[model samples]
Target chain A: MRSFDGVYEGFRAPVSSQKRSLPDSHNPAVNMASVRYISKVVKALLTFDNLIWYSSVKYVLRRCEEMKSGGAKALLSFVRVLVNIGWYAYLIVAVVTIIGIPHLLFRDYLPADKPMPWMEHQPGYTITFSDAVSAEGLASFARYGLVLGLPNLLIMLFILHNLRRLLAAGIENPFTLENARRMRIIGFLLLAGVAAEIGVNLITARFVINNVHIPGATIRANPLPYRGGLFSALLMLIVSEVFKLGVLLQEEHDLTV
Target chain B: MTIAVHLDRLLVERKMSLTELSERVGITIANLSILKTGKARAIRFSTLEAICRELDCQPGDLLEYVEDGEQPS
Candidate 1:
């Protein structure tokens, strides 16, 4: 295994050299001190080496190096393809959400007598409806679909666009200011997505309560617990700040002679 | 911004090219060029000492502090 001694030597080798040069004294104390120092140095070197090998920081740095050298071009290309797939898939879904939701109002309502598959297992309360859905109820549902789905889809489209550009730039140099800016935008959009989700849920929940009706079922619409979305947004924001700092530091390092 | 490098002047006075100085000082030409063009943010003491030694000049001869609006001497 490669050791960090070469790099560490450039930082500090004088102390180790001086310790090695201690005169050969008969005192056991001196011998013990030398032994202890050697052990400590060896431990430090091993620990440093292990950290370099095992740390995710090493992985990220190596990945960045690979990106800069075009070694990860194939992987980036693959990711770009996946992002493209997601971009178009969401686009189709967005179109369906827009067109299909309104179209549902015109379709024949579900059989008024038949139990809804979703309501079949209601344990205590029997779900009974006079009409499967009224025109107002269907219209509210369509409105909810558009209100919730469109913003999320648009945010995702924006995020994907930024990610595609970021990946493309990463293939050349991932350390540019523009890349950092793109990352920041993506982070904010992610945060906005979470907020939009909550907001839309609130709006649609109100609509559902006012417009939706059933005889025995008390319908309640609750906001989804988007913990993953929230966590990812916060993480992306932190990473963007770190990336910005790294880029600034890299600039300073390059300018330093 | 206030500390102006006199490397070009010193190099000319010493009758040495930047390449010759870079070779003697064991610094890359690109780095020396950065220093020459006044684009370098900071210089290592070791690099400064090496350049001074090769140029046979004091640190003050290679570096001068001027006011923001004043032209470099």
Candidate 2:
């Protein structure tokens, strides 16, 4: 937390006798690696399973930080590459799912002529829409996709943008006003996205129950009516405020020192 | 807001430059400027001790409390 760690080292030692045993937070490679690590942590915040894979990795990083190991940067570099690649892979998967869902959902791949064996006891006849304007199913799918996908997309972009700023500050200057503002933005965005999703889910369920007519039998709509994930967003907002206070205190400390 | 620093007066009296005081006290010149310019939010005991030791003065000699209704210092 103290950038003052080695300041006294240089002061106390004779210029020629000074050994360069310090955190290389200034190196471009190391800064970028830290950025990557922070980005990975941000991405991991959304997921529990992904964290399982990184549990050992995180512990190792913490130990390295504790030991002040200069060589740990090499390890951080490797982990940075892994986290960067994995995040891209994850992003690609989400994008593909967003694009592919409608393609698969609306296709006449299942013949509308008669219900396939899976439709047995299920009330809907397979209806294919030539155009989305006339078909309720197409409308529902498109609405659901936009409602669900857009918020998630926005939240991801916003968080990544904020995390980039935070990480670019590196370990020394993490408590900048810019980073605090970004964190606050991220917190608000997460809250808004989650709120919008829960609201849309209820609306979507209702739409399905009412508009998705399958020729008459009991058609049940599984409308997941519960809202969730507010606690995490609330916690993030609190953290953002703390960061703001940190920025203020950091300014005072800077002036003091 | 009412507290004022007389670091310049002390430095003048001691015939010591801010940079020399900073070097002797093991603090940066920028921080010394903060104290001299009265922009510091607070001062630490160690820093005060160092400054006091360097200047051969008491804390009260370098610091003054002006009441809010007092004329501009």
Candidate 3:
């Protein structure tokens, strides 16, 4: 399997020599992040590789002014394509899951410690894939789907809305007031999705995972929790604020001319 | 909110059109319009000097600081 830094270093190796040794006043990680952020911004706005963004900001605004305003015609923009693919793939997976879960639950398999037919061979051994379905399995599946799947669906809907806005907007000025508003909405949704997960974990433990006994054993559907979404949501909110500021600046520049 | 540009008066006194002053000062008409309409955020010293040189007026004559009690004319 490929390791993480190997891919990153391949992209950065050529530029590494161009960067000087870090100074005591600056943190290397912070500087690298800023450089990457600014580079991405510049690349998106001007389609240039210039590292000195300060000098090009005015030039970029001028270029934006020169570009004619109208709705974008192409239906397959990067975000739109990616988001469409993701939603469709997720839908297929969800459908399969919906079918598979019920099928698994309804299986008429016996609860026994018998070896598989393959194990009857004197020189061979075999193992069964599952024990009888636990009493709490269906409830666990429902909670998992409710908590994880619902937020994912919401995120897809938000992205679709943003894609529509982008399609309706001019190519020159992709960032509009509507886009900024949607960005903020998406950011809040992301945070809410995290909160929903936490709530689901608690509700699952309390209600869904009732202490129950099967024929011979007890079942406790303990769930593993995650908080990475919280950090990502916070980052999105901050980026939304920056998007708002960019919209304001773009408006001011447009009116100035 | 109190600061005001007296460019219209200065231009009338100098008998010069805004375009003529803008050309002589080498500043864009849009920027000069921004200044004349009191929409400018700040005036650079070099630009102020250029405007003053072309219009034959002092900085005080071109700009005024109106107090809260008085309405700007």
Tens-digit lDDT track for model 3 on A1-257?
22244433454554444455446228878788888999889777774444457657775565445443422333235345566676677667666766675564544333223222321222233223243424234334544554455565655556556645555564567567777777677778777777766666766566433532233454465454566787777887888788789988876664341
Q: Scored by CA lDDT, what does every candidate get?
A: 0.77, 0.68, 0.63
lDDT of 2 by residue, A1-257 (tens): 11232433443455324335245665789889889999899877767766765897897777667557656455555555555665576578667777877665554332223222322232335522233223334334554565476666656666665655555455657788788787788788878777766667776766566654455554565544334557667888899999989989898888774
Steric clash pairs (candidate 3): none
Candidate 1, B22: how far from true, in Å?
2.7
Best candidate per TM-score, number?
A: 1
TM-score of each: 0.63, 0.60, 0.50
Clashes of each: 0, 0, 0
Ranking by TM-score: 1, 2, 3
- Highest lDDT model number: 1
| lDDT tens per residue, model 1, B26-59 | 9999999999889999899999999999999999
The segments of candidate 2 whose C-alpha lies over 4 angstroms from its true place after superposition are A1-118, A121-147, A207-228, B67-73
- Candidate 3 is graded, for docking, as incorrect
The TM-score measured for candidate 2 stands at 0.60
**A1-257, model 1: which lDDT tens digit per residue?**
22333443443455456566666556788889989999999999999988988896776676677677776775686578789899889878878777886665455433323333443234455544335464345534655566567788889989998998888775555677888888889989999999998988887777667744566668788887588998898888888888899888988888888
Where in model 1 is the C-alpha error above 4 Å? A1-78, A95-125, A130-136, A139-147, A207-221, B68-73
Candidates 1 and 3, the one with greater DockQ: 1
Residue A234: error of model 1 in Å? 2.2
On DockQ, the candidate that comes out on top is 1
